[model samples]
Target: MKDKQVLEFDLIIAGGGAVGCLLALSLRSCGLKIAIVEASAYACDSQQSLHPGFDARSIALSHQSASYLQQLGLQSSLLENCVPIKQIKVSDQGHLGQCWLDHRQQRVEALGYVTSQQQLGTMLYESVKDADDIDWFCPDSVSDVKQHQQHIDVILSSAKRLSASLLVVAEGGSSPTATKLGFQSQVQDYQQVALVANVKTDHPHEFRAYERFTAQGPLALLPNADSSFGLVWSLAAEHRDTFLHMQNSEFLQQLQQAFGYSVGRFVALSQRNSYPLALARLARTVAHRSVVIGNAAHTLHPIAGQGFNLGLRDAQCLSTLLRNTVKQDGDPGAAPVLQVYSQQRHQDQSLVVNSTDALVRFFSNNHGPLVAGRNLGLGLLDLCGPLKLKLGRAAMGYGGQNAAS
Candidate 1:
């Protein structure tokens, strides 16, 4: 029998989704050799069709997240395909409560930017392909991981072994490696599913985003570059199939009734997709020479478009810490290094997860007292300038000092 080939790297990353790719790219300047093992085949020409995470779904990138990507030298490629969100209009249906957040009030160019997941993933893949320090392994995955005193050994499905000083799992919430390693996650099923699609209206969005709380759930419309809007409508799980199977005209009519004519008439809608909403967090983020980041560490509800933004923050923090470790000639997976990363990320992760959960629970309830109290709170938030600005900043991923790595 022939001995399996053994490869060596400073870091071995599992999964090649946005978060995984971002981590690989962010660590480029660190001068450490890195390799990414992805289960799905990724071809530069067909990335969108091959990767499920890089489908037609749109993502809202916070200003802070854009800054981090810019630092990694991806601003030009990504921003060109993005639509700036100059303002956000938040309201409650059949209520007198409404709030608006404008970029001008926050003294920023824009609150956030919206772009399709495929575009961003393509940019990340292209950037990584041009780099010489990183190794790309697509159509491959880590079958098992074993920790040793000096390094971790990753057995690949292709019968190859990779030795790395540190193992980072950015494989997202359903990572098999995390499960095999005995990582426990705290999962809270929101009992809601989100229906996402690209929709066109009679009037242009004018660089505005809308979040309307309806009797069903929260319905969000993000402005798209092509004068359409990206729709994320949260509804009860039992009702999801009904809308999914409905004819386009009927679906649009129901959507129109739920969401008022804020952006004009819903003239058209593209193919619709549904995703179960849940808040999942790993019990422990770091163990031995391995660490989990991004969705693999914590997955948040998409209430305020915070899941991917929170993951970007995770990549930023971990990459920064790892870069510093390389500079000090320290172990990337050392206990001290992992401890600092975990401790620093605890507050932001907790805040986003809990806040998103609270929003979904409070806004989705139709009880009279709860409804009255929430409406009153919304009214006060709109009336108070300082308080509104604070909440806006938080939503824009710039709330607390801890959020900034």
Candidate 2:
């Protein structure tokens, strides 16, 4: 079945990041032809330094997200490096109100888990390595795109053109491919930057994650395994350059001030990374025969760490839709089929987009009244048992419906 000149596929995914690879694997068991175009040359590396993109950014996966990975047989592999999240503590720094989300109440051993960006990416790549249905064209780039009534064609950087009925764009923020497919993004300059690093803590942290609001923005310390924790401190962009240039000692001292004595001594710290924070939402989900997924569709604030998990949910749901459609002898890329998938998955997706957006605006304001109001709400939530449980479940990715797609 080797074609000498051109290769054709039922689906061609442009970004082979976490979501793209997982999407291909999820649908591999289904009857479909697939090809993955990854811009990067290599997918994974066991050694940390050898991997270029791991960065310091980590993820806090919710329950439904965990179950989705479990269903995909990636749970075991992921758990090897994951840090279980037992609870989340939310409060306004130096304020009276606080709320705790306990995983035990949600009938789960762990609320969620934390893993590095590079580790997650590597695990996903390995998971899809043997998927026979997907022809992973790594060290490849999408040079050009053309949409015809019959098929969508992608010209590779190598000057080879490939055609498919559907294309999933998983590239990074403001993906050119998504834009070419008529996707428009609503960008909000939060005027903030996220500063991330890993630090050794004296206290156990007890697998408890903390979200504290300071004058600059939301300061979160997500617990990792051992006596270490990861930091995602959102600061005003006007002040980012200053903080980004601070020596490790100076930065740790400032972090200690905002973090108080919770994490004990922060030591053996790694280098810091600063990323501009913004929310880019696509006006529509699908355009022509191409659909945007992951960061290509939306980029949310890191306040809740739901950015990546939300993208994973998209992959799961989309794969489910395609699998069911193919079982019915249907073309997975038909406009009618794509429309249904977009609509059914809209509410949950929108909720995440809106909630993350609201969270940043809600906590970023340093005004007096807003601060008081937020603290009062936190106190009220802390006192309300049923409400607290609901919040816990919601934060664990079970807020609306199930973690389908």
Candidate 3:
């Protein structure tokens, strides 16, 4: 640790979200000087309140992503509370349409994991608490930013100036700061909103996640450790309010209608959240002395629950780039360096976004011809081992280095 409190660092990150915080913590063992400029300080005591054992929003993490998390020294404690999604079930309601994917059929130990987004944050937060190298700033935000050949300077809302060789923004999909820094994005509002909640089921989920396509949209029920399914129910934006305002009994009935009986009866749910759905792709993933990770760079449909996986892959790829560069005495924040990082990330993200978006469109309609074609496609996929394998691999995020680390 440096003796002086206000000092420069090798990296300064904007936004204290999971991605940004994980980036700093990942680089800790390198002993590189780093500081995080969080918009909000831990000003509110409520911020420290850890929900039950896990968060409402969970993640479908690929084997590669799990390995990457483990590589960062985070799997043991993280997995302790996480449920292993041994298989994934994709089907439609009432048509007897269903397909199953398991590691054995896929020739892997496990397809992925069902992990709580907040639990991972909590684990990282605890793990990094004693690491003296990475400085965290919360309850404060970056007000002004300046970049030059040598370093980047930032003025916080508190009028404090901080500098670093490189800056990373991992706030979320929509960030004004990233926009001001010349980050233009191609955003497609799904015209839909994802309604998230949890529900206790009569039968155990058996460690499986379901992505059931419907006329309204795709409703996903990911397994919780208990006999419950964490739901990410997406519907057309126009109908979102109806779902939000439904009385408890009405909500449960609609949930039953949307989710179906794969998980049995619904008892109750909590931590309900409604978010606007969209696909936003940044024009350029990196620049002179800064880079974007997490939701700030790209956000995809939750149809596959691959949003965080995409961000985790970004972090892993960026870490590899940084590691390889310093090993060769290359500048970490060089334009060419950042550009390379962007290129590598762009190709991989393209596939994820396209596949997820296509699935959303294919499933969220009632066209007679389209319905028949999709049902045929699903049937064909089930019959053909090679085709099914291809999709399983793709969904498991093995498209390329963009996914499989």
Candidate 4:
């Protein structure tokens, strides 16, 4: 029998989703041997298996996120397929309070860009695919992980042994690997479900996004590159099945009633998909030589569209620390290095998590006073230029880094 050989690397990322792939791309110039172990096949051809995190769904990339990708050297190839969101209109259903945020007013190119998840994922994967320093283990996953004094050892389901100086888990919420590694997450169910679909309107989108707060939940219509609107409608848990299975025409009618005729009439609808909404987070993100990031560290409500942006920031911060450590020829998984990452991410993570949770709870109700208050606040926000500027900056994911400047 031949002796089993073990592959070694400076870092091993356990998830090949958007976050993990982006992290790998961010570290391409860091001169580290990187391994990405993904259970799903890195298949992009239409006839191949579907990638979970990079499905047919679409996502809004904040201005900061776009800048981060550009900094990672994906500007020319990526961003071309994205549609810019020049303006965002926020309002309450059947109320007079509303506000408009314009990219021109914010002194930036655009507030954000919308693109299909599959395109971004494929592009990131392509960029890292040919790199000599990066190795991909697709259709395989980390079945077991053990942390040691100097390095962490990983055992793949294929019985391949691997060793790494650090292990980063981006396996997402409800990750079995994270659970096996003794990471406990506190999950708060919002009792709501988000129904997402691509919707077509009778008129052009005009590069605008809308957030309408209905009594039941919040509905968002983001401009898509295909000249359609990507709809993310949050509804009570009980209504999940009804909306998911509703006739296309009826669904459009209900959507129109909730969103009004601001974006013109809804003419067509695509297949609907849904997932239960919740807030999940770990008390601590670092454990020994391993660290949890992306959805593994915190899963948030999508009310504010901050979940992915927040996860990307996690990758950005960790890569910064790891790159610096590599330059210094120091240990990337050292306790001090991991500690600094945890401490630095806590503030931004907490703010986004808490505020997203608050928005879900506050906006998903019909309390007379709260409704009046929020509407009034919206009115004031529109009237006050400074407040509008601050909100726009924050919406652009500038809470930590000032991408606006």
Which lDDT tens digits does candidate 1 get at residues 270-372? 9999999888899889998888888988887787999899888988888889998999999998889989988988888888887888999999999999989
Q: Pick the candidate with the highest lDDT.
A: 4
Clashing pairs in 2: 313-405, 316-405, 317-405
Per-residue C-alpha lDDT of model 4 across residues 1-405, encoded as one tens digit per residue:
212487888999999899998899989968899999999886556775347678767789999898999888888866687999999999999999999999999899899998888878878888888889999888898888878888899999999988988999998888878887899999999899999999999899999988899866899988998889988999999999998998998988899888899888999999999999999999889998999999999998888888999999999999998988999999998999999898888888888888888888889979899999999999999999999999998899986642111
Per-residue C-alpha lDDT of model 2 across residues 1-405, encoded as one tens digit per residue: 323566789899988877888798788768889999877777244454312444446778777787788888887887887888988889888787888888877878888888877777777777887788878787788888888786788889987778888888988688888877778899999999998888877778898999999876798888876558888899999998888887888877887777778667876677788889999999888877888888889899999878887888888888888888889998777898788778877887899999888999989887899989999999999889899998887788877655453
- The count of backbone overlaps in candidate 4 is 0
Each prediction's number of clashing residue pairs: 0, 3, 8, 0
Residue-by-residue lDDT tens digits, candidate 3, 244-301: 8877678888878876777788878675778899899887778779999988998888
Show model 1 residue runs off by greater than 4 Å. Answer: 1-4, 44-50, 401-404
Assess candidate 3 and give its TM-score to the true structure. Answer: 0.92
- lDDT of model 1 at position 376: 92
TM-score, one value per model: 0.97, 0.95, 0.92, 0.97
Per-candidate Cα lDDT values, in order, are 0.87, 0.82, 0.77, 0.88
lDDT score for candidate 4 against the true structure: 0.88
Give the per-residue Cα lDDT of candidate 2 at 208. Answer: 90
